[model samples]
Target: MTDGMTYRERARTAAHPTGRVASSPVVRHALGRAHGAVPDPVTVFDDETPAVANLDPELLRALRRAATDAADDGVEFFVNGGWRSPEYQEQLLRGAVSKYGSEEEAARWVATPETSAHVLGDAVDIGRLDARAWLSEHGARYGLCQIYRNEPWHYELRPDAVENGCPPMYPDPSHDPRMRR
Candidate 1:
């Protein structure tokens, strides 16, 4: 019984949107380059820009093949997430800190950019709510798996989990007893 925004339910406030500055000239100037000024302070998430958010062609090919296999087996799935930037992740962490408390407090809910699989441009989240439960039975054949203890909607490819396995959005766990298990 999953509802929309399953992960959004954990956060007390809304995270800043990713495409707020979609197609801004400032982003174009700096993309692929190591350094440049950005029009907005927020980092864009994967798929924010067609070029920056694209997946590796080889990986995409495998994903398509797996998807085709699943479809033949009567399962419906799609790659739902792609690349994310450090700046965007920082913005998310800031939001989490605003709601939670410290950087460590954020990790419990969101990942840190350094550790995120999304930044690597290979991980993706795929899920199905159908009763046949195709994803549960077949997604590994494609190299995707859910990540984190809190967000089921999040998935990635770990050598162990993908057929396999965020921005570092959200706050880490808090030192306060009230925030931790």
Candidate 2:
């Protein structure tokens, strides 16, 4: 359906294919927007977008608490991805497969719908390097912790972390036990 082009290439073409008036709906759907995608400028506090509003309540609360403190230090938390629909997860997996040239390679980056924390509303991908750094240094106090060593932007709530500290991270999604499901 993508004419043998990778998803990124197709996205570029759909966004500006010589005289194209608008982006292709198919591309948008495949990317994220049509499946509970996070809106631009979204923060941990956002409750209007399904991406944020659909997050697990405890996770959202911890994120908000951490974000509020991070803000005082001039670091703002921005949501890059959260609470994805299964269709969106599959689309992303397909794109990853196309980009990485194999399912094994892609698994390091994107999890299958059945194994993805985003699908369960328990994971969030935060944007911006400074925000990630802020979280990296102080997140444990709020029960928020980076889940993967390779994905500094991806976080999850671990209530026990506030006292016991965050557990060791897996090298990547592929090494995560949950991803084996």
Candidate 3:
């Protein structure tokens, strides 16, 4: 009824390839459950600078452009999350499930670590009421698309959107078939 590995080891193994997880000591040290230290939030963008490290570099350029435009319109964009490790993602899922009190309800907000776009370094969670509102109107011009109607804060780069505009949003993460694992 028990594997030899500790809970942290089991969670890590189930979340991603063991060797891959082992190689990222920063991720392990920051995301592992055993005495893990939550790393300081990286500043991907701020009033003075537009920097995007440890996130999807391809998406950053477009995001920076959009953020700049939003600023010009008196809306400040802030990145609250990006490029989470699978372990960190699993932790988030557990927290969401606990708060929502059901797997089905939690699935509407969070994806399994294996299916998470953040785990792949391709998604971002933005903050600021004005920013989210502005992005909703103009983000498609920069290829930034809000994938979930429920999570107005979440956005991903969709190159085609620069010309064609973002496709209609899914109602929530649960409605996205990619989240079914």
- Give candidates' CA RMSD values in order: 13.0, 13.1, 13.4
> Best by lDDT, which number?
2
Instruction: Give model 1's clash tally.
Output: 19
Please give, for residues 12-105, the per-residue lDDT of candidate 1 as tens digits. Answer: 1122132122222323222442221123321112224432334444344444444445545554443334445656556666888777787666
Model 2 residue runs over 4 Å out of place are 1-33
What would the TM-score be for candidate 2 when compared with the true structure? Answer: 0.80
TM-score of each: 0.50, 0.80, 0.73
Clashes of 3: 0
Ranking by lDDT: 2, 3, 1
lDDT of each: 0.42, 0.77, 0.67
Q: Give candidate 1 regions above 4 Å deviation.
A: 1-53, 73-75, 78-80, 127-133, 158-181
| TM-score computed on alpha carbons, candidate 3 | 0.73
Evaluated at residue 123, the lDDT of candidate 3 is 87
lDDT of 1 at 4: 47
User: Clash pairs of candidate 2?
Assistant: none
